[model samples]
Target: MEVRASPREYDGTFVTTQFGAENVKRAARDEYRKLIDKHDSEDVLVLTGAPTSTDAFRDTLDEVLPGATTPYVTSPVVHATDVLNQTDDRVVLSDALRRELRHRFLADYEWETEYLRQASEQPSFIEDLDRVMDTISWQNISPEETPELREITAALDAFHNWLAEHDHIERGQLIPEALDVLTGDDYNDIVDINAVLAVEFEEFFPLDRAYLDALTGDCDLVCIAEDDASVRRTWVETGAITDYVSFSESRRASGVQPSTRPAATAAYFAEETVVDDPNTGSVSVLAADSGDNQLATIANEIEELIEQEGWGYDDIAVATKQSGSTVTETIESFERSGIPTESATITGFGDDPAIRELLAVARHLAADDDNEVPDHGLELDTDRLARVGEMDQLEDAIRWWATDSGVKERIAERETSLDARSQFGNVRRAFRMAAFLDDTAFLDATWESFEEMLERAHEYASQQNQTSATDLDGGVRVDHLQAIKNTSFKTVFLINLTDSEYPGDPFLTRLFPTERVASMPDYPGVTDLSNTDVDQTFPTDSTASSRPFVQYHAEHARRCLAIGAEAATERLYCCLYEYEDTALEERAQASRFLTAAYADLPWVTDAADPKITSEQAAEEFLLSRVDNALADVRRANSQDVTISLDEVEAELGEIQELLDKSGVRGEELRKALRARVEFANGEVRR
Candidate 1:
C-alpha cells in the first residue's frame, strides 16, 4: 500500500489522514481545495457522518476554495437515497406509509394496546425491522413459540413482499439497493468520481461499508478520522481502502495542543477558566429543585450572560437528551423570560392542547352507545352536542365547535399556537381516516379502532419539528446533543443532566432481544464502536462509553455549563399519585458526569429566584385589574344590577400602584392597563 503524507501546509493533494478535533477543519479544507483544483469542483462528493459535519465541511470549503462552486456534500443515507430515487423502476414509501403499515401490523395483535402503541412509536422500529429482514434468518424461528416475534417477522415479510409486488421501497432499503445499483453498468456514470472523502465517522455499517467498497473501487478514498487505529484498520479491511497517513504530528505542529485533563472533562466544562483564566470564560454546574427549576436556573444564567458578558442570544446553545415535558417547560420558561430561543429538536405535537381536545371530542363522538362527555372543565360546544349525527360531518362539526367554543382562541393565546395549528391539521387527517373507514367493518367493530387511528395520528405529528417563533437572523439555538455537533457557541447550557437523561438510557431495539441482537455476526457490537456509530445494536452498559460522545458535544462551545437536579421531587409526587393508598418511595440521582466534573469546582446549588421583569409585572398587574373588573361585571349581571364606578376605580388604582412599584410607569403602563380592562369588559359581555 502506498501512503502519501502531507506536512502542516497544504500540498494540493488528498490523503487519508488521522487528525484531532482542532485540525479536522483545516485538513478538510486542504483536501477539498486539492479535489477542486484537480477535478471540477462539481465532480467532488463529500460524505460526512452528520448533517452538522456536512455544513461545517461546506463552510470550510468556501473559505479554502473561494470563488469555486460548492461541491455536493451529504450524509451517506441521504446520498444513497438520492441515487436510488433517480430510477423509476421502484417507488419509495413515505414515512406516513411506513407508519400506516406499523399501525395495521399492531392492529392484528391481541396484546396490550399500549405496549403495541409504544413499540410502533420507537424511533428505530422501522429501521430495526428492515435490518432484521436484510440480515436475520426468519425460517429458524417458530410462530407458536414466539408469537410477538412471529407477528413482527410476518408483518415485515408482508411489507417487503408488498413493496416488491408494487415496485415500492422504503427509506431503509435505499442504501443497500443503491450499493447494488452502483455495481451495475447503469450507475457507472454516477459512481465515477475524482475522490470520496469520509469525515468524522468512527464506524461503518454493512450497508455503509458496501457503499464505500463500491466508491473505493471507482475513485480515490480519503477518510479523515480520529486517532483510532482499530477503526482505521476496520475500514481498510472491510472497506478495502489501502493508504494510511498520520496527521497527528502535523496537527500538533499547527499549534493544536491536546489538553492535559481528560477529554471528557475538558469537553464538559469547555471553558478557558479550566486553564486558570477566569477572566477569559465562564463555566458552572447548577443543582435545582426540579426540571422546571433547572430551566428557571438556565433562563437566569442566560439573562446574566447577556447583561454581564455582552453575549447575544444567538451565541448560546442548550443541549438535552430528550424532548420531554421538561423541554416543554423550558421553552415556556424562556418565553416567560421574554428570551427568544429556537428549538432544533422534534417536539411531540400530541402535547398541544388543541390536538388533545380534538382527539377527546372524536373519542366522545365515536362512543355512540356510551353517550357521555368526559368533563375537561373547558366549556366546549362539542360537549353540548348529543352526537356527531354523521360520520362525514365530524370534521366540520369539530372545527365549528372548536371555533365557536373559543378553543382556537385559547390556543392562540399560547406560545405553542403554531404547533397547535399543525396538530389540528393532524386531527383533520385522523377524521379523514375515519371517514374513509366508515363503510368498512373496522369502524363498526369498536370505537377503540378510532382511538388507535388517533394515536397513530399523534405519532405522525410527534415525528415532525415543532414551531418556535425565532428571528431569522439570530436567536438562542436550542437543540439536542446530536443536532448541535460541529457547531460552536460562546456559551452552552446542557440541561436535564440526570443519570438517566444526560447520556440517556442505552437504547435496545424492541424488535429483538438485546442479547440476541448483540450476538449477531453483522450487528455492530458495543465494545469497539463510538456512541454515534453504534448503529442499531445495543450499546455497552458503561457510562464511560456513552458519556464521551455527549462530552464531545458539550465541548463544542467556548463556555459550556450544565444543570441537573440532585433528586427528582416531581417523580416522588408522581409516585405518590400512582400508589394513592399504598406506601411508596422514590429517589433520583444526578448524572455521575456532573458530580465528576464539578467535584473540585465551586457548585451553584440555589434555585434561581424567579425574576419578575417589568414587562411581566405590568402584565400581571393589568391582568389582576381585568380579572377584578370581569368579576364585578359578572356579579352585577347576575344580580340584575350595576356596580358602582368607585369600586372599579379602586381596583385600577391598586393596579397602577403595583405597576409603579415595579418601575412600569407613565403612558405605557396606563395604555396597557386601559386596553386590558376594555378587552376584559368586552369578553365578559360576549
Candidate 2:
C-alpha cells in the first residue's frame, strides 16, 4: 500500500495536491516506510527518478541494516528487468510475465484506448480484434486460459463501454483478470490494434490526424523503434522539449517538424530570473535569450525580479501561444522551479498532474468514508458541505454522492418531482450524473459545481475547446492569452508568433469556389491563394479598400505589442525563433510586431544571444516553406487523392504568387507545380 500524501495539510486534511515528479518520490518513500512499519522490508524496493534515488539512498542508510539493503533504483530499464528477476524468477518465466509484457506493449499505444473500447463495443470489431489476437496466439496454454481470456476480453469491453457512457471512470474498474487475458501473443498485434482501433473509434482518430495535418501538423503521433531481436519500442507522447527546440530538431532531422506539433514557440517557468541589469536599472541585453529559456530559467529570473524590483509572483504570468506541447513544458518547468502552474486545455488525464491529484483525493476519500453512503437519496445543500470538515474531504464526498449510481438514481427522482426551468433542470441534472469531484464545502463549492454543470465539459476538455484561467496561490496564471487580452503581463514571452504560427489557419470545413477571393465586404477582393499562384491581374480599383498583409499582421502584432505596453512597469520580454533563416529581412519580419514597435520603447536581447542575421533568417523561412509544401503533399495523399481541378488551379495560382515574390520564375517552381498537378490528377483518376 502506497502512503501517498501531500506535504501541505490544510486544517488536518491535506489540501488537494498536484501529483508531480516530487509527489511520485514522496509516494515511493511512504510505501517504503509502510513496508518497514509492517516489517515486510525484504519484499519492498523503491524506484524513483535519478535525483530522488540519490536522496532516498542517503535518507535510508541510517535505518537499513548493512548488506540487507533493499534495492533503490532509477531508470525503468534497470527497475523493470532487475526487479522482476529478484522478486519472481518463476513468476517472470511464466506466461503471466509474458502477459504483463503484452500489457506494457498495449500501454505504449494506449492513445487508442478510446478506439479499442469503441471497437470492442462493436461486436464485429471485437470479433476482428479477437481474430487478430488469436492469429498471434500459440496454443500451449492451460485449459483455464480460454475461459480467462474470454473473461478478460469481456471486462475490457465492458470497461470501455462504461467509460464511454460516463464522463470519467473510476480506476479499479479494470480487474486483474483483464490483465490475465492478455499475453505475449497479443503483444504482436499492438500496432495493428492501434490502426484498426483508430478507424472503429471514430472518424476523429484518423480523420482528425488527416485534417489537422492539413491545417497544421500538431496532432498526436507514435514512433516505433525495432531492435535486432525483432522487439519494438514505441513512444507516443509529445512536447518534452520547448517549441524552438522541437522545431529546430524537426528542421534538422526531417526538413520540417510535423506541423502537428502545434506551432508553439515560447514557454514560462516559475522562476524569477528577470531580464533587468542590476547595474543600470534598465533592460538587460540578456533579455532576448531570457524569454527563450525553460520555466526553470524564467523562475530564477522572476525571483530576481521580486528581490530587486519588488515584484511578486502575482505580478507575472508564464504564457505561451500554443497549448499542447508548449503548455506541458511550461507546467513541468514551473514544477521544477517550484512555481505552481496549470494549463487551459490539458490532454489525457494521465499527463495532467492536477486532474490526477483530484482523482487520487477522490479515491482516498471514497475509501476512508465508505460507511457514509445513505440508502436514502442525498440532496446536496452546499451549505452542509462544510459540516464534512476539510474542503478536500467535502469534495470527495460530493463527487461520490454526485457520481455514484445510487446517488444519480435518487437525484433523478428529486428532479422529476421539482418544478424548474428545463435548461437549468438539465444542467443541474448533469451535475447529478457527473458529480462535482472538487470539494464543495469550501468557498470553492459554487465554482466546483460548475466544473461538471454540463456533460459537454468532458467533451470540451477532451477536444481542448475551452479556455480556463487558473490562479495557483500566487498571482501566477496559465490562461488563454486571448482570454486576458489587453491585460499586461510583467514579463511576457510571446511564443509561436511566427507568421504562419500566430494566426495559423484554423480548421476549415467548407471548401469555397477556387475563384473566390478572401476579402471582407468593405475590402477589395484578393484571390485566396493556397501558397501557389496569385492572379494580381484582378482589376484594381484605387477606390476599393483592401485588406493588406500589414493589417492582419498588425492586429496580431498589436496584440503582441500591447502585452509589452501593458507591462510598462516591468521589463517586457518577447521570445521568437527563426528556423533555417540567416537573413535580416526574415529576422526582421519574424518579429514584425517588435520591429514595428521598435522606436517607441526600450528593447533588449538576452546574453545567451542567438545570432540572428539577415541571411540565416531568409534561409530558414525558405526552408520552412519548402518543407511545408512537401508535408502538404504527404498529408494530401493520406486523404482521398481526388484532386479537384479548382484545387489544381489554386495550386498554380499559389505557385505564381511565390514566383512573383521571389522575382525568379525558375524552371524548378514550374517543375514542382507540374509534379503537384500530376499527383493530384493521378489521385483523381484513381
lDDT of 2 by residue, 1-686 (tens): 01112221111101111111222223334434544554444433332212112333334322543455644322222233332333222221112112222232233233234435544444344323322232123111112223323443444455334333433222111111122222323323221111100100001111122221221122122111100000000001011111101111111101221111001111001111122222321232222222234233455555566666676666666556544456655655555455544333443232332233233333333333547533323233434433333544443444544454244454445432221122233334333323332321222343233332222232223223221122122434454343333233455444444544433432111222212213211111122222111111111111111343223222333333332222223454444554423333343124443343233223343434333223323333344454555566676789755544565457656656766676454455555555565665565423
**Least lDDT summed over 10 consecutive residues: which range in candidate 1?**
567-576
Q: Which model scores highest in lDDT?
A: 1
lDDT of 1 by residue, 1-686 (tens): 11223312212223333323445666677766766777776677888755445665666667765565666777776777777767546765544444554456444444333544567567666545543443322112223333455555566566667667756676656676777877887666666576776665443444464576575564555566543212212321222122222222232214243332222233333322223322323344455545554555566666766876687777776665544444555555676767776554443345556667766766666564654655555444543555443434444555565666677566567644444454455455555655544533323433555555666656554343222211122566665554554555666666755655444443435465655543333332231234433211111222444443233222221121211110111100000011112234234466555555556443222233435433444355466667778788798989888888788888777766766776535557777667776776575423
In order of listing, the candidates' clash counts read: 0, 53
Q: What is the TM-score of each candidate against the true structure?
A: 0.59, 0.30
Q: Which stretches of candidate 1 lie over 4 Å from their true place?
A: 1-21, 65-71, 89-91, 109-155, 189-193, 227-255, 258-279, 307-312, 322-341, 352-454, 459-475, 499-590, 599-686
Model 2 spans with C-alpha error above 4 angstroms: 1-296, 322-328, 342-354, 357-433, 436-475, 486-489, 496-554, 578-589, 598-686
